[model samples]
Target: MGTIELLMQGFAVALSPESIMFALIGAILGTLIGALPGLGPANGVAILIPLAFSLGLSPTSSLILLTSVYAGAMYGGRISSILLNIPGDEPAMMTCLDGYPMALKGKAAEALATSAIASFIGSFIATIGLVILAPILAKFALKFGPAEYFALFALAFATLGGITGKNQFKTLIAAALGLMIATVGIDISSGVQRFTYNSLHLFEGIDFLIAIVGLFAISELFFFLEQHAGDGLKKVALNKLKLTAKDILFVMPASLRGALLGFVSGVLPGAGASLGSFVSYTLEKKVSDKGTFGKGDPRGVAAPEAGNNGAASGALVPMLTLGVPGSGTTAVLLAMLISLNVNPGPMLFQQSPDLVWGVIAALFVGNLVLLLLNIPMVGVFVKLLSIPPKYLMPIVTLIASVGIFSITGSAIDLYFMVGFGIMGYVLRKVEIPLVPVILGMLLGPEMEKNLRHALVLSDGDWTVLWSSGLSIGLWAVAAAGLILPMVFGSILRGKMKRSKDGLVD
Candidate 1:
């Protein structure tokens, strides 16, 4: 069938009563989770995966719900960034540069409204891009051989440093740790234990879901506990909603530019939404500023929101097309798909066209839902800002604990989760990036398998890894990924820190 007809059928599936209901639920839940400080979309999605499974939703329905949550979380992230000068997630960090300033100047309503509009526009543009680009990319990925696949995985690892732009060494360390973790369990080729240490639990390898919850959700709990002392949110007054059409018109060009830039960033492996938001804000600040860009410019609020949201949509391109995630949240979602026995990649469209198109159509629907929901519900989310960690942490803990336990019913898994949580907390304390580790865990085995397969095909000829044009090109990109970050990381980090200095409290 043609892409258009497939999309029409996808809409039919997405618009089903059950799909719509779950989409709504995901949208609402995701926003609330994103509005909460430090939870982000990755954690929001991780914490809810068990819920989706326990509820017995079909794979398509579960994906629809989760993808809706992903979109909503992207929208919701701007809330704390604007009102509290505390980003709900890393991608939202850029929003705080001007969003909090606008809020401080009694333009909170305008900032929120502008960001919501920009987010919708960005996501809408990205969804269109996904509709156009994903299939083409998937078809291209069909040309990939084992060597090319190995090179692609290397490219993912090489570029992962862009997510943090802090320290490539630390990122590599985290990724190495994850790869080591991935080595646990029996080796598929040898059918012999590699790192199980004679334990049956380790025989199956560390469950990525357990690791995801531990690293993102459980560790977040520990971090909150450690940092919660004397950390209080100051209330911001929400002035009357007075966003004029002229105001919207003023930011349109910036929003469009940011969204396009953001989508490109999102499509690149490992660059993700953080890069999208950072570059969008930086570019908009340079080209359009009349010396009012950072002080309280609505365009400042709009640009990053557009950029990050666009990136969120763009990140799905690699995940759906190549089975390689473009961002941390998508990594978690990738794990969810694996857990559900649905492999995502080039064949996914041919094998599960209904699921792929349904997700795309649902994204379109979810964006509309978020636009409508965010505007009227701004006050509610603002109230959520005042909620204490004391009351909130337990619920996150409860949900995570219950969800993980429900999945395996294994006490050993729970103990391992706690161990991983402690490890995550320590890693965060040392300022090592976590996303790369997750990416490594998700991609390591696949990387190893591809490498071994390629070697065997060439009779153990290591040079075969770069024999093909496609493989060579991928290797070149991988080299650029590793080298560019070292050259540019400091400049980007400096710019981000300077922008963050605008925080009032």
Candidate 2:
């Protein structure tokens, strides 16, 4: 079938009454949570995962809601940034520089309108990119052998340093710590308990969800408690709601460039939406003569919104093609797929055409929904800011705890969650990146499984690691992923020094 025909078939599935309902619910909830500070796509997914499970949501339905939530959250993040000067997450930080400035100038409605339109453009562009690129990538992925798979994992692991905080060494150490934690259960291949300490519960190994909840969800709660002392909350005005034609014209080029930049960045393993936004912002500044970029330049609002939305879609590329996530949020989605027994990778398109196509089709529909939802409901969403923190935080905390507790009904899980929350708080304070820990936990088991399988097949022949050209190429990529960052950084630094000297002269 032609691409258009196939997409139409997929849309038929997405637009069904049930799917549409769930999509709308997902979008609404996603926007609600994402607009709140400290609650981002990753955390929002984690918090709601248990609820999704409890509802016995179908895998497709569940994913539609979750992914819609992801898309919606990306749209809603700008709401917080533009109005309160507080980013809903790291990715939205750049949006705040221009978004808030627009709001301060009583252009809140225009700022939101531009952001919404930019989000639609980015999402639509990325969805089209996915439709065209995903199949090709998946076709090539079918050629990968076990060695190549092992090398791909290694490359993803090596790239962790680039995404983490200033202390790359510490990030590596934290990642190693997570891997070690993964070893606590009985080894599946050898049937030997590696680090269980003889506990029956440990025999099954630490649950990935539990660990993630502790590391991120719990950590965030503690951080919230600390920041609770601050008085930064501000009400957003909802009087104006239109973007001028000139405003649209001004931001069009930047949004397109940002979408492309964001997609490329998101396709790289470990570089999440935050990096995409940062790159797009820098690119726009370099290309445009706008002095108000960080001061509410409409392009500033458009660029990051476009970049983040495109990055969100682009991150799906690696997950669908390689079964590896390019970011923490994708890692969570990957876990969701596994839990549903839906194995991703090149074979996925063939194995689950309905799911894959449905997801792709839903992206297009979801973007349209967000565009409609964002513009008309601007007042309602803005009103959400009025719900006082005293009331809001408690409800959020209660909902999160209740949702998580519903998953396994294990009080112990709750304890682990709180522990991780405290750990997350400390990690945030120390500026140790939490994402690497989650990424490590998610990939550690897969990496080990692939490595052991390859080793067994090779019968102790270490040289078999490089037996395939694909494996060698992957190893090369892995090596470059590690080394190229330093080379690039040095080059950029030298150019900066030269520019400074020229300015002085």
Candidate 3:
């Protein structure tokens, strides 16, 4: 089918009551989860994976549901950042720089309205990019060999810079741990037990959904308690959430710039929404002093919100085309596709055009739902900030427990979930990043498969792994991701110091 024909069919499905209901459910649930300091799209999708299974949703509907949550969470993240001075998720962290300050200045409603509009613009533009670019990228990826795929996975891990925390050693360690854990089950090549340990659960290894739920959702309780985050909450007074005509006019260009920037960044495997938002915020910070960006500028609100949402859409590009996820959430979505027995790659468009276009169509609806639902209802989401930590934390833990049990159907799975939660808590205490761990877990086995395939194709020739131009280019990118970030960071720090010195002089 042609792209337009497939999209039309997809829209017919998406506009149906069942698909629309699921989209709405995902959007509402995602907003609630994203507004929490503990959960975001990854956790929301992981926690709800079992729901998709239990409901026996079609591949198209299930994807629409999950992707809607993904899109909604990107916008919903701004709520807690603006109201509580707490980032609802990683991408929202940048929003807090200006959003909370705006709230402090009695402009909370205006800040939130700007955030919603910017998020819509970013998401809408990036969805258009997805529609236009995904098929082309997929066609390009069709020519990839095992060696190129292996190198691309390497590049994926290496390019995951800002989202994986600052300490490179720690990020590598977390990734290494994931790779090791992924090897726990019996080896397919040799038919030999690796880490099964005679346990039935070990026979299949830990499911990524179980691991993600424990690591992200349950682990948050520990942090909340340790930091005493619930007490002495900041109260934000909000009026009607609406942007003035002047405010709208001022932020349109900034939103456009952020959307373009974010879409480009998010196309890189593993870069994710946090990097998009950080880059957008930094660019706006340097643009001009007209609004004093750090001191509650509306343009500041527009930039990161647009970038993060744009990145959210852009992150799907690699996943849909190359079968490699750019962010943790997309990793979960990839896992979802796998569960539906649909492989995402260059052939996905040909093999599953209905599913592919259905998902794209759903994104359009989801973005619209986010804008319409969030803008006027910003006050409703803000009220959640006042929920007492004591009351809220336990309920979250309970929900996590229930969700895990629902999916696994095993008490042993609960045990593993609890164990991982403890591990997650310890890792977070030491400032280790969780995103790389997820990437490693998701991509590690794929990497092993590609490496083995490349060797087999070359008859055990190691140099064959770097034989092709594509593979060499991917390796070069991997090398650059490892080295260039540090150089750029140092340069940025020096510039900041010089600017401060000039101000003093």
Scored by TM-score, the top model is 1
lDDT of 1 by residue, 1-505 (tens): 7889999999999999998898899998899889987889988998888788777789999999999899989999999999888899988998998898898899999999999999999999999999999999999999999999999988888988876555889999999998998999999999999888898888989998888888888898887788884445665678899999999999999899999999999999878899999999999999999999778899998999999999999999999999988988898899999889898899999999999999999999989989999999989877877777877887888888888888899988888888888888999899997888888888899999999999999999999999999999999999999999899888888877877876666
- What TM-score does structure 1 among the candidates reach? 0.97
Error of 2 at 370 (Å): 0.8
lDDT tens readout by residue for model 2, 73-176:
89888888888777887788778777877787788899889999998888889888988888889999988877788898888877775555235566767777
Best by lDDT: 1
> Which ranges of candidate 2 are over 4 A from the true structure?
1-5, 229-232, 290-292, 486-505
Report the candidate with higher TM-score, 1 versus 3.
1
Off by over 4 Å in 1: 229-232
Q: Write the per-residue lDDT of candidate 3 for residues 1-505, one digit (tens) a residue.
A: 6778878988988889988999999998788778877577887787677677767789988999989888888888899888877788878877887788888878888988899999999999998999989998999998899999999888877866644535667777888888888898878888888888898778877787677777877788777777755563555668655567988989998899899888977887757787788788778878844767767888888999999999999989999998888787887888778767788889999988878888889899988988889977777776776777778778777876776677667899888888888988889889887767777777788899999999998999999989999999999989998877667755644543453232211
Candidate 3 lDDT score relative to the true structure: 0.81
Q: What is the lDDT of every predicted structure here?
A: 0.89, 0.79, 0.81
Better of 1 and 2 by lDDT: 1
What ranking emerges by lDDT with the best candidate at the front? 1, 3, 2
TM-score of 2: 0.92
Give each model a TM-score.
0.97, 0.92, 0.92
